[model samples]
Every structure is written in C-alpha cells, then in structure tokens.
Target: MTALSEYERLEAIGLWRADPQAQRRDVILSLGDASLVISDAKAGSALAHWSLPAMIRCNPGERPAIYAPSDEPGETVELDDEVMIAAIEKVHTIIESHRPHPGRLRSFLIGGVVLCVGAVALFWLPGALVDHAARITPQAKRVEIGRKLLTELSKMAGQPCTSPSGDQALAALSKRLPGHDTIVVLPEALMGARLLPGKLAVIGRNAIEGPDTPEVVAGYLIATEDAAAGQSPLKRMLGDLGPSAALRLLTTGNLPDSGITTYAEQLLRQEPTPPPTDGLLRAFRSAGVSSTPFAYALDPTGETVLGLIEADPFKGQPSPRPVLADAQWVALQDICTGR
Candidate 1:
C-alpha cells in the first residue's frame, strides 16, 4: 500500500467479480492474519489468498488483481465508493509519513550489526560450534531433552492421550523400529517424535494413531532422528534456557541438567517451531519413508504436494506397512473407531 501512487490507491478496492461468479461480485479488501484473503461473500468461499507479511499492492487497481513486487498477482476487490476510495488514499499517506523513532532506528542498526557478526561466526567457525555442541550435547542429554519436550506436547494437544487405539498404535510402531527397546508414546510437545539416546523413540499418541497409514508414522520418526543427527537436542533445551544458559552451552559442553524439565513442560503446553528443510529431507529419505504422508499431514491438498505425489517412490512398489500384525492391526484400527 505504501508503494501505491495516489491513483493506484483508488483502484486497490473495488467490485471484483470473476466470470461464472458474476452474481457474487463483491466489494472486497484483503486483510487478517498472514493472508491477503479475498472473500467472495456470495460465493461462500475465499476467492483468492496471497500469503501475507511479504505482500504489497504493486500496481494498485490496474486490474481486479495486484501483486507484490516479489510475489504473484493476488485477487483484488471493487471499492468504487468515493468515500472508501478517498479513505484508502489518506491511510496510505499517513502510513508513509510515520517513521520509526531515532532510538528505535539506532537499536535496529545495532541489532543488524550483531546479527552480521553472529552470521559470520556461524559460517566462519561452524565446525567449532558443531564440535562444541557435540561435546556438550551427549546422547544421554538428548534423551533427557526428548522427555522434557513430550510433557509440553501433551498440554498443547489439549486433551489426555488415553485412547486404547492410540496406545496400541504406538506399541505397534515401537515394534517396527530400528532399535530393540521399549518406547512409550506420550503427548506431543515440539514435534511428533523424540529419539532418546538408548534408541528409544517417543511419539505423541496423535501422531501414530491418526487417520494415516503406518508410513506417515515412520516418515515422522525418521525425520526426528535426522534432526538429532545434526545437533544434540540440547540446542532445543538451550532454546528454553534463555541467553545465559545458551552462552554456557556455547562456551562449555554442559548446562544444568535440571533445565531439561522446563522444556518438557513447555512442550506439553505448546509446540516448538519447525526444523530446517535440508535436515527434514535428509531424515525423511534415510528412514525409507515417503514425503507424501507428511506433506498431506501438513496440508491435505493433492496439488500442494504434487511433486511429492508424482515422485511417490512407494507408488506401485508395495502396499503400505500395516499399523500392526494382522490381529494387532485389526485391534488397533478398532481402538479409535470402537469395536
């Protein structure tokens, strides 16, 4: 909007109607959480949505659609009302005039300098950091971190995980793993699975027991382990440790083991953010798992993951892994659906 010239501002809002949807021509404006969502109120669905924060109206209202400089064209709406048109223009002017405080600008510059320094260090001495991490983040510590993450995961899931099917599903998954050890599926915190040092993988009950084939569960488990391979889970633990403890992890290969529990509690209450993409891909491929199930879990659209779908290595390979042995599979399926 700030980029819009006075004329473009007038065009940004107006009646936008598509062919075959003429009856639903609507006066639209895009706003709301992280989307430039155009509501075709009469059509009963969003006409178009552009992911937000990075989007801006580039050409104003040249057409019923405008795109950001770096984004694709997004659907626009009709705002022919003289009053609304004038208001949008005024708003744009106000926005352009509002500048950050000098203090804030100084802070931003200082922060940017620090970020550059850190980035250089991260790249210049990456080996040192990774080596230091390896020393500080031992297997035993990762296992402890995994446990802490689970406690928080359960809380975020918003319900107790006592379903017999969920329990049975987890138990079945445990049987097919790389290690011969017992695993307890608890509630989720940061993600779906936690690989303990002893080859024990902890899963959230919802993960394995969802409306998915066994492949989905395997894909997630492998991905989590791959994440483990890159760094010790203590980075995650240090995430909850605040700055002082993070410095400790950086300088010394140790943190107070007691800090692990707080992370676990946070996991139960909320989810951790997603992992880096390269790490995700490595984990998925190493585990003999397809990207299809995980993609679907993130989004159900067949088109969103069309590439994964086309390259589905499992296509015509063989049937998916059963959730359990014949008897166990049947029992586990009925665990949630009811007998």
Candidate 2:
C-alpha cells in the first residue's frame, strides 16, 4: 500500500519463470500494496510476490520488458503488454520516491522520541531542546546544513584557493586523513583547521604554506576531527542559535535563514576551541603522524605545546609514511599565489 493510490489494484497478464533454468509460464500479475503478486493463470493461486521496492527492471527499452524480483540472478517476469509495463514503471517510481534514504528511517524514529523528551525537558533545562535536535539530526541533513553554512562563510573568508596543480596537491594531502571527504584550503582569515557539520574540513593558509611538509596540514586535520568527536558541529551551531531557534528546530527540524547567516558570520570572526591533548595525541597516533611539527607551528617557542612536542607519535620509530610528495607540497604552498 504505497502513496500511489491511483495505481492500486492494477492487473496485467505477464509471463513468469521461477528461475533462469525454468520454462516461462503464463501468469496473472496484480499490483498490490508495495508488492507485485504473480498468480497462476490456470489455477488463480499466488505463485510469487515481488516487493516493488526491490523490483529491478532488466532488459529495459526492449519489446518484452524483463524484471527480476531483486538483483539476484533468479525469478524473472517478462511483460510484453505495454499497458502493464507502463503501470509497473509508474508504480516503481512512486514507491522509490516515497522510500526513505538508508539511514533516514532510524533518524526519524529516534528524532521522534527525542523530540517528545525535549518538549518536556525544555521548560526545566536551558539547552535540552537544541542538544536533542543535534543528537537526532541525520547525516544527510547535516551535510545540507554544512553546505549552506560554507556558502555563507565564503562571502567573508573569500572563495577557497584553487589552481590545477594546487587542486591535485590538496587532493593528495586529503587522502592521508581517514573519513574526511571535503577539505578546503582557505587563502586567509582562518588560523587553524575547523570541522563543519558535514565531514568538511577547512584549513588556514598558514597551516598549508607555513609548513615544510604536508604533515602539519595533516595534523591540523586530525585535530579538527578529534575536536568534532568531542563536540559535534550541529550542537555548537544550535548553541549559537539560542533556545528559541532550538525549540523551533525541535518542532520543524530546521533553523531560520537569518539564524544560519548570523552563526556563519560569528564563526568567521572567532577561532574554534582547541581539542584536548589526549584525544589529539590519539588521533596523531592513529594517523601515524608526528605531532612535533604541528606543535612547533602552533607555538614556535614550544613552551605551551610542550606536551605535543614531547609525546610525538612517531618520534623514535622508523620513518612513517610520507604525507605527500615533495612536488605536491610545493604546489600546495603556492596554491594561493596563483603560480
């Protein structure tokens, strides 16, 4: 029973086979709630039921369109009837449109429960609603929000530095970090790396151009990732939006455009809090990157970052894997210079 009310009870004659080796037999195909029911033409008894959502059209654009119950190489239905083919296609499209993305179902169910809890807790607690919204927000939705915020941030920080060689170099450096999808090297304004709502990481020009090797940039990336693990970007954003927007998010699952704009401006003006040393050390160890270079870069005196310098992950071990090639590091350094 899908949202396609008009296509319900649609019946058509089709030929079906139980397996690829089996002979084709005539059958009556009836479109039922979220499934296609194939019944024996002679006995009128159900033969096989194929879930519409799992239905795969094989040999598309052919006179006799063939379909399989699923991607598995067995049990196919062939329909030469144009009316039946069109009906199946239409129903499939509708069902696919209504189907939730992979993780959306869980997010929706969890969000529902969290929203109820937040509603009751909002009156007594200050940030319960925003925290709940952040916890329940799906990864897909967070990516959308992150993209929007980045667009706004660009207005202030300027567009990310891009050049043919520089782009390739940046891509090479990004591959060293695990899980980070999009990493942008900003020309100026930013002082360190910051993780956005999605798996987007932005690094300052200094982090890229100032370091002799790509390990410094890698260190910054790892630090930002560790920071995000400690405090999610969505939770920080909700805090910036205040309690009213948080309440609205609890009910509507979105914030106003003005709130996003204001927050984006605020982020451009401020530096993100540094992640704890223990977590950052773990990240460096996991990535097999030395923390000494990044530590010196952060504090040339090495007075404040003594812990990072003293406990370098690959200090006494054999040389770890190179972060990037010599040529790539050179290209990355000149990314903003347009050379």
Clashes of 1: 16
Across 1-339, the per-residue lDDT of candidate 2 in tens digits comes to 652677677788889999999999999998887788999999999999988888999987887899999898999998987877887888788777777796888899999999988877766565777788888889888888888888777777878888889989877776777666777877767778877787777778989888786778888887777876767888888888887887787788777889989987787687766788987888899888888888888888999998888887787342278888889889888989972
Model 2 residue 73 lDDT score: 92
Which lDDT value does model 2 have at 265?
78
Give the residue spans of candidate 1 off by over 4 A. Answer: 1-145, 148-172, 179-183, 187-191, 194-200, 226-229, 239-243, 246-258, 265-285, 316-323, 329-339
Query: TM-score of each candidate?
Result: 0.44, 0.59
Candidate 1 global TM-score: 0.44
lDDT score, candidate 1, position 207: 59
Steric clash count of candidate 2:
2
**Local error of candidate 1 at residue 158 (angstroms):** 8.1
lDDT of 1 by residue, 1-339 (tens): 433343332323445545324554654554433344565556546667644434455557654343332344433444445554444445445664575579888999999999999988766555554455645565665565455444444455433344565566557667765552545555434346665433555556565567346666566676665655555455544544665565565676455555655655554555434566555655555545666776676567866655555565555232355435555544543443431
Candidate 2 residue 143 C-alpha distance from true site, Å: 1.6
